[model samples]
Target: MNNHSMTRRLLIGLMTSITLIWLIATVMGLSVMEEEYDETFDSSLQETAERLVPLVVDDLFRKEEIVAPQQLQAARPDEEGEYLTYQVRDKTGKVLIHSHDAPPTPFPAPLQGGFWSDDTHRYYTATGVSNTIFVQVADAFANRREALSETGLALFLPIFALLPLGLALSWVITRRALAPVDDLGLEIEAKDSGNMELLKTDALPLELLPIAGSVNVLLQRLRNALEAEREFTANSAHELRTPIAGALAQTQLLINELGQGPGKRRAGQIETSLVKLNHLAEKLLQLSRAQAGVGVSEKPVDLIPVLRVLIDEFHHSGQDEDRLICRCAPNARLHGHYNADAFAIALRNLIENALIHGDPDAPVEVSLKADGSISVVNGGPVYTPDELAKLTGRFQRGHTTATGSGLGLSIATRFLEQMHATLTLASPASGRDDGFEAVVRFPHQD
Candidate 1:
């Protein structure tokens, strides 16, 4: 099956749009979160510096004198390094006091009151005691980056889990929405010459109602046209049969009366022409009936007896019994819900065609297979693909010089189709180098 189904396409398109939207929203949210983190960290940095300025000044005033930078130990031993480090310095930038995690050096920030930053940390400096004391608080860049990275990952994990769920739900919804379209297609496909019932559109969506209406109109028109054609052909053949038969009988009597003269020969020719006309008219009647859908039945019918009867009729109708052969597989069953008369008509045509067109020196072979298919093979000149294709058309003789109306195959094909059986033609009959073969395959029953 093709992977380009509409359901699959819709599902992919919808899911792709949804996933892209989600990703775009996530990116926007992460950007905003990063901006907010910057402001919050900066505010904390400034607040810590200002708040510690007064405390550092008071502690230094009680020191009496400052010898070296003092590292202020926490109340308890701190295992993790401090996220915020600070240093208290003088106007000349000499460090006087610092937090536990602060480096034993003056901070890189200038000894003034404002915000500044370097590669590793953001710094905020606060001046107190008439600009004599300076306090700077440092916030690590890595800490802010870690917080943003964790937050971005938290926002991304849901997308992976939700995308598949979203696609599955979309699939169910899509299939349900397109169900009516599928049903409509199947209904249209089922219509044929034998079944032209109107489409049922009661359950169809509003969008599909117009399509169904158009199809119904088309089917109605076709049904009417076919009915008219079949009626005309049938009536013409029925009306011609009686007159043609009387004329042919009179011609035969006249040929007998004008014995051994040029008139007799001319009468013979007329007789032959009359016989051909009668055959043509009979074929037309059969064709009309086939077109009228006379091949379908409502119950299983045993078709093997029909085949045997046709063979017997051919044997009694001046065909050489020795030149016709029949075979059947052991325990083969030929049962199908098709009209027996129609099957007989199609099979007889195949047999007659084979006898008339086949090589006079070779025999015609008929066989019924174990699977219920019937094959008719006769030794003859092999036909090309193009020639075989045209042989089934009405009035198409395909290079044969034989006497025939050329409607045999056409009628057979039409009747078989109405019966839901298929007739396949092939040259170079199975197991033979040069011949033609026709096979009738019935649909398998459950």
Candidate 2:
């Protein structure tokens, strides 16, 4: 369903398959090796039995012959190696001759001629030396187990060595095979709302091409939908502005024609409504321009002088009732697309909002530091965290029903965003202090 799910499933499937295949191969190889070892050991046992038959038969017939058991035991085996023991017995099962170091356990009951017992520690091959004498050769079970264990180790050693190599190879293959997915993620990350274009699928493998194509198609559809919505809002706002302007003009004309009365009061109400509508229209225009990424012209600009000029202008602009305190360090400059007009507009909006909402008699302090940072602090009822979050939204008013339009903070925020700057709002450190501070940071000019 999602890329994470798909990737997880693919990785699990590959790991499972590799594990199963490796296990099967290891098991099969071990089994073959075990079988070969069993066959070779059995063959050697049979060959040893055959070679010992003559010596055992001769010794059984010559019952009185003085044969040295130690000399026979010391004799080295020829082509057929032997680790064996023998016993010659009468028809009544009485031992006539026996090899040294034979087990105390009784040999298996005699068969027709020869028989092997895997559970017992013996392979009995009986040969009649005469009508009354029979000879038997036997080997031990310990030898078989030893051989099998050795063979198992031989088979398992390579597999143990290969496991690390397999894991390493899996890692390499996984990284290489999933490289396209990583690239796709990077490509998506490089995009933003302003540049939501369809991604190309040409570089993807055949197996992944369809997925990439679908993603690109979805991106295209989303881009188209967003563009259509923006166009509709912009066009509708433009169309309504003219009609609202005309109605306001007519109302003004009527107000002029009729002297002060109930008619003048009604006209005043209409004019107030027109002013609110105009404010809304202006906010809409500002929001549209902000979304369109307008009003940026890159150049080095002295921020200290800009802050001083704005404070001076605000002090002169119909706010003599309020004290404006300005503090700025000398020669602080920032590197960015600096639109002097936009900067002035944004700064004025912040200062005006502070002056209106803050205490009229108290100072509205504006401070600019040498690090290209500016802070505007005002004594006012601080907004809650949620309220502060919404302060940058269009048409959002603060706690009080101030007569001014609510687009001031939103416009400043948008302008700062376009200038590659950051704006932060915080309450005074006492936690419940009835004052708010707005800080703006501009990158230092190179």
Candidate 3:
């Protein structure tokens, strides 16, 4: 997961570039500083050699004993200035006067003048007093490097301090710059098929605009296509209703006129067929609506009121009111935020199934808990596990004797799923051999 993060990669790339560039600059700076220091020190060495020219000429050109090494008047060898080692030689290349730390040998090739070097030292030679005598000044290369190393440490110390600060600043800037993209991802994840609105791209950065725009275009196409499909289903059901109802009415009239004969019996059969067709048409419309639409209400739905309304409607519509009973949890409100229309469909299906298939003498049980759980129990036929497994499928029926479109439970199941709720069928809910139960549990929110 860490390796897959784009922000991590961006931060790492930026910091790496800063570090690489700094390293390159540091190396270049160190090189330039080293060259400059070498020039300054080499010039100082030449000056020291030139200054010794006259001094060596005054002492060595005269017929005088060689000055003792202690009398050279240079800084003591124990001091830091011991880096400078000087030797004075005659024309024959014989060492005469030398610093206490200097080796008793010519610093460079015999008779070699100006500046020269060996494996370890930089030497500058100057002729003194008619070129008969020479003074050579030498400095160790290691001493020059030690001084330069200190200078380089001083320059690099600040860079080490700033590196962490620079990396931290880059991370903060990178995260802020990409925050909009993360917000866009969350917004997309929240969108569902129920939402037909286009994704807005105008507020995004220029680099991301095209991607968001392309996604919006695709969503627009999907919305248009879904709208067309829903329109077709509705229009077809409407168009089929009038002809189917008219045919059903004509068959009934013909059955009445041709009473007490085979013709009347055939007409009666036709009437039954027409009624079934009408019922199927209505079910298809309901299924289409259930599949195509989603409901989102701002206020919570009060289930007690909702159930009362459904029960009253059921009674007014010629169903036995006393056969259905609704029980709510005492002293508590059953409020749910899921789509009310969808909830109505599911609850209505459960109650209808219970009333249609249960023993006519036994009352159907309806329960609503404070936890937002609803259940419908009836003295219907017990179901085998196999039948329960296939129960929610289209046109699948639990009882062969019951007359229904067989789409009620399937439609209810589909709608409930859209609301993140579930419907389960239990055979003999009381552990007896004679009842069936349908329980609906709505998703909970914190």
lDDT against the true structure, each candidate: 0.89, 0.70, 0.79
Where in model 2 is the C-alpha error above 4 Å?
Answer: 1-13, 57-71, 74-83, 88-100, 104-106, 109-112, 126-135, 154-165, 232-264, 295-316, 319-323, 337-349, 411-420, 429-432, 442-446
**Candidate 2 local lDDT, 1-446, one digit each (tens):** 64565555666677678667867887787778667866776676666666766776775456666443222443344544446776655666655565655433335647335657667555655555544655566766677767667866776676678767866677778878888988987887766545677787778788777777887887888778877767776787798799999999999999999997999999989999997887677656655655555547766554456666777777678755357888776665554667776677677778877887776666778877777777888877767899889988877887665577788888888778777788898866134467878888876655
**lDDT, model 3, position 248:** 92
TM-score of every model versus the real structure:
0.89, 0.78, 0.74
TM-score-best of 2 and 3: 2
Residue 152 displacement in candidate 1 (angstroms): 2.1
Question: What's the lDDT of the predicted structure labeled candidate 2?
Answer: 0.70
Q: Write the per-residue lDDT of candidate 1 for residues 167-232, one digit (tens) a residue.
A: 888988999999999999999999887788899989999999999999999999999998898899
Report the Cα lDDT for candidate 3: 0.79
Sort by lDDT, top down from the best: 1, 3, 2
Residue 376 displacement in candidate 1 (angstroms): 1.3
Q: Is candidate 2 or candidate 3 better by lDDT?
A: 3
